[model samples]
Target chain A: MTRILMKGNEAIAEAAIRAGAIYYFAYPITPQNEVGEYMARRLPEVGGVFVQAESEVAVGNMLFGAVASGKRVFTSSSSPGISLMQEAISYMAGARLPVVLINIMRGGPGLGGILPSQADYFQSTKGGGHGDYRVLVLAPSTLQEAVDLTMLAFHLADKYCNPTMVLADGMIGQMMEPVEFPENYVEEPVPPKDWATTGCQGRAPIIIKSLALDPVVLEKNNLVLAEKYKLMKRDEIRFEAYKINPKNRILVVSYGTMARICQTVIDELEQENISVGLLRPITLFPFPAKEILAEAIKPNIESVLTVEMSMGQMVEDVEWAVKDKKPVEFYGRTGGIVPTPEEVKDYIMKILAKETPAVKSWNG
Target chain B: MLTSFPSFDKRVIIFAGAYGSGKTEVAVNYAIGLATSQSQSVSIIDLDIVNPYFRSREAAFELEAQGVHVIMPHNEMCHADLPIILPEIRGEIERSDGKVIVDVGGDDVGARVLSSMVDAFAPKGYEFLIVLNARRPFTSDVAGSLKMMRDIEISSRLKFTGIVSNTHLIGETTTETVTEGYELAVEVGRAAEIPVAFVSVVTEVAQQLDPNVVKVPVFALSRQMLKPWEEKVKAVRGL
Candidate 1:
């Protein structure tokens, strides 16, 4: 397997193509526009349908149309554009379509600015679109994870019959890094077409829609989605625990770009004679809740601090995972801003001083 | 005769135009017009991400004074690189009050930010208007304008409700330029499957030309800044 230097956006696009996405429709938005550009040139080479849709609305609907035709499809956009696609995304989730959406988030409130920000954490994991449904969200911290998760996202979306989102930020989208494509690219077997809108033949006419005017039918649909989500929780929980030991006192939780930043903070804290560990969540929707609880049960761990780019959206999850076992703290910078490694290290040290007796002993 | 304007129970109208199309000038005046036309609360969300100068923020003071809520990204966290999804704006979307005008940035690139809120507005009805200046680059002809429309739609992921034909060259624009631009808009409107909501004309020329030159209703625009009632009078007088 040859390793090549690729940008995160390019890697995800290539990964999607190799995963059998034959239709790619998108409008170019910065930070992730390169994904659309790359697919625009490559999709034609692979005998795929590539259209720059009329708007994010049209692109999303086009994806819905392509996915409805029983073909693998994907679309990429930034925060603002992804926000526009929420209507379609909700419909895809309700209709149980295996659509792949890549959100390379940028700064926003109203065109906040085109820079990296994790302000979309709540939107991605908690269903950005309105509906009683959830999308399988994969947050990639590195370019390799971006490629790997995108490949997995396709399989998961098809297996569970739901939409999947690859949630990354501008830094990951723009940064060039080394990535090795999978040796045996897993070709997902075309599942039974019993649920698709590929024509009725002799069977009942299939309606692929999210609307249910009848309350009874809508409740049944909600139950089905709920059952699928429960199964997903059992089958799709993923995370990376770094430097976990029985003697560890602090658990630092983060994801996506923040997870990479936490790694640096952990390294610096280790140099200061503090035993700090990290719980990096790769799947934000099927969040690694059980793992955090399991680590919290260990008596040596004293506290968990969640670091993020937003004003503490994901911190709520950290609190839920730790419960009352330990004091969960939150440190964050929001609105298109990122905190440096040194600042994160300072927060970690402050937590350690307050919670760990060993750190107090060393200071004395 | 009676005029019926498109109204929503709680919809946000975003007046997004191309750069140098006097979007700030139109947005400021339109917000005032919309606010006074009906006895409802109208808020202006300044989402200009391109061309730092001549933004809706510049008119924030005047708009706020007119009792129109002015929401700018800078009031909270103004960053050019991070994704700052405004949870506060969600409140406005959920409110059953007046209109929220989102004056987005110019061009497909700048207007792309609307895609982020696809989740929020799709549930609640949101109407997006693409203000077109046929004289601007990429909109100088029918084909070029269609391409721009397609790009904006794909990027924002929101269907444009209608087109606002606003063709002017600062002070150089005339009734002839406005008419040619209106004609070009008809072709674009047909291709995009959307109607030309209004054709904006300067008050000086609007008074001279037969209002029927614009197939759609005419909206009067003034170069000089004025109160909401004054602007509404201009738009209505042109009609």
Candidate 2:
């Protein structure tokens, strides 16, 4: 009904409440601490639950507990905290429990820094935890998109009986932008949490487990997970292409905050007739390989530049998607450094200025 | 007796106040008001480096579309948490004409950045107005508001010339709330020894108030901070 200026963290917290997330358990982490603070202060008015767990490990288990009881719940964390929660996340994934996790990523292999980053791309999309399981990962580039995707994450998690991760960078978490909450955005038509472990009263006991000791049963569990992943890839592949006209010679590929930066690069370059287009992946787990493929193979396309806020993790996927059909170049700024639009534009120009392709072709 | 936005004889107007005092929103509305008034060309520099959560830059496109130039750090830096102070701002500050609105960050830590521009701004003085919201935490009393203004002035190396009360309690804000806030604003202005620039009342609530009751001019405010769901809740509950 009305638009309001809101920070991404606070917006997500309010959106979760608006979406009927009755239970939220999270440990405080930078660039996302506001989410916990907002929930702790506001959840009571809405008849919801908010717990500041002692640690990330505890919060992860708490998430599993809430979801096991068939309630909408989520937790937000940064890189190091998410790393500590991986064990419980792995358990939830293997157990096929539905939960929402918002990872507002910061630079890290360890506690690197608190600035915006997309370095956690591999850890998120390639399955951080142990198994053949995949979390439905949604990457949002703007504050409104973050709110929209978070609401969608709850639906996706419940509909598939799988954990869904809202993979945003520190920028999306800390930045202030105008956002509108969907009118009465409550989680509706709740897919029967018929599998919940709510005290089996006068009914058959339900058990949800990830610990399978027998090799045969474990293999079957893995296969079942693989099938779910396959279905998610088939149905949930989301991507957005900006200005991918025939005259464009370069395809800039990125997602989340990086994609947003590339959009600016495209805008600035369009003035000079540099003809750069952007292919942004909205769902990082499904990877949007098909859409990127279609745009990258266009007749006038000369090169594909995979830009990231990390050491070229998504570039490998781009290369694999293209499979040497065209050269997929990588440009990234790691360790909490967010590359400027000028830097990205300059990087692309250097690639374009080359007299010929930098790499030898796949020739006969 | 003033019935509309006030005239600005000064070239540059700087908005500075304590955190959550509604400075950014006031600056946005004030800038828009000035732009629409055709008194001068307007440009806004978002100088808030302390809080990345709310700043004037978020409304740049809207202001720009209305022929108001918005100057902020380019690209991701506009959204980043880094303390990015560019030289481009100095150039805007040096301009002798037009209304240059500087929406500074809240508190002294936010105002300290202005110290760097002292050399460029000293000769041509600016109107430094402290936006006051009595409802904001730690500012309900006259002493607290003055203390905050003193801290900001000491750090910014500039004295405040006026005060604007832009208080609210979100969707529930009423004329009574604005009246109470105005009482505090008057008390704070008397204590701090500054003029009351104006008291902003939401257009809906402003209609119900008597202008004679307000000691200073009333600036009719159209709330720009409400989000969609918040407005829905307000509409449903009749807030």
Candidate 3:
């Protein structure tokens, strides 16, 4: 396979095409506008659908309808736009329509600046919309990983009968890197579309809806979804542990682009004779709690710092895994501010100094 | 194969092509090359409004520090979604004591912006060079190259005076890869009835290639669009 330079947004868009996505409906928003733009130009060439819908609200519904019709469909948007699509995303989840969504997250509670951020971590993992549902969230730290995870998003969405979010940030979207695409991407052997609305040809018509009038029936539906969630936690949890040594005292936990920054910090700290390991979660939904617990309980591990581009969302999950056994410190820069490796290194030094006051002299 | 570019007779030169065709890289190199090697004062404008990643304006400060004039969007307009061609464009077009190279946006949509400025450049006899990088999906074949050239001309309301074969696979570009692109570019030039202008490669890549094989004018490049993450990624992956 030949590797080529690609930006994260356009690479994911092309990956969606290679993954058998037949339709793309999106409202362009930074820093993910390239995804929609590239899809608009490339989709037609591949006999796929690309619609620059009037609004994200409209495109979200379009995705629900297209995926409900048993066709592979996906959309890309930033934070504000994803917030607008939550209603339809919830609908797609309730209907069990397999659809892929890319969130190249930027700063915000509202119209935030168009820069890299992981503020949408909770929005992606904690269920953005009002419903008893979950979206499979895959966070990619590299452009190649972006392509791989994006392709897997479709397969996983279909396998689980739910939506999968390829969560990224503006830095991931705008940064250029070399990526080799899968050559033998067989789009076949897809999930069975047994519940599609392809006309009532041979049997009783089926209805897809999120509403349940009967409390007893709704409780049963919730239980079934909860079991699936448990299955995901058991079988589909994905993470990567870097340089994990039993003698490592500080474990730096991070995801997305921030984790890449954390990897550099680990190297810098290592040179300073500090044993720090990097625990990066690939699948944000399953939370990699098991991996976190195992690594955190190792001897000589005194602290775990959760680094993020948001105001510390993933730290809560790290805390859940730690269960107060070890102190899990949170370091974050919000509103699209990507903390530099130097800044992260400084933060790590501060954490170390607090642990043992003499450690501050190691900075030189 | 012309080993040397024709003298800077034309007041304005425009570079246009597919988004990843190395237009910005070429324009920056061309401007710097002229400023250092020639007697002409050079000003390069970044009018690219299509893709935002690899714009010439990103290197404006570097170019200006070296006595080359760089005119690009200012203030918050740097990140603006819509295209905003500065009004100074007319003045720059009118008062041409030296050379001005306009790095246009990619595709017909971007060329449409250039169409509006053709009248100003027409009197000065501007040269529009359609850069072709065979690596890009849109210009990977002879047919694709011709189709894009025709579409670009139609939208820009100008004829392409020459073609620039700037094929590169980022850091993986080899001599044979460039020679293949040069061959493809020769066919494209024949079909378009235009001269195959100088081919471009980074200086290091040029060293490995026997110049006799390419037989084309070469512009050795300096990689300018290094993003924040690329250096570390290259070190880690060793690409």
lDDT by residue for model 2 (A1-364), tens: 6455466887888888877788999998777877887788688988988888999999999998889998888999999999888888899999989899999998787877777789888888888987777889999988889989998999999888888999998878876565678885555574688889989889999888789999999999889989988889898999888988999999989888778778877887898988988988899888888788888899888888988888878887888788778778888887666777767777888888874445422221
DockQ of candidate 1 against the true complex: 0.03
For model 2, what is the C-alpha lDDT against the true structure? 0.81
**Superposed Cα RMSD, model 1:** 18.3
Estimate, for each residue in A72-187, the C-alpha lDDT of model 1 and write its tens digit: 88999999899999999999888889999999887767676666778888898898899799989999988888999999988888888899999997778865555778878856
lDDT accuracy of residue A293 in candidate 2: 82
Can you give the DockQ of every candidate in the order shown?
0.03, 0.07, 0.22
The stretch of ten residues in a row with the least summed lDDT in candidate 2 chain B is B230-239
Candidate 1 chain A weakest ten by summed lDDT: A355-364
Question: Per-residue lDDT tens digits of candidate 1, residues B24-138?
Answer: 6767777877787788888887777653333566567667777788776664244232344465666776664677788777667777888887787787777677787766544
- Candidate 1: which stretches are off by over 4 Å? A187-190, A199-204, A355-364, B1-239
Scored by DockQ, the top model is: 3
lDDT of candidate model 3 versus the reference = 0.83
| Cα TM-score per model | 0.60, 0.68, 0.89
**Candidate 2 colliding pairs:** none
CAPRI classification of candidate 2 = incorrect
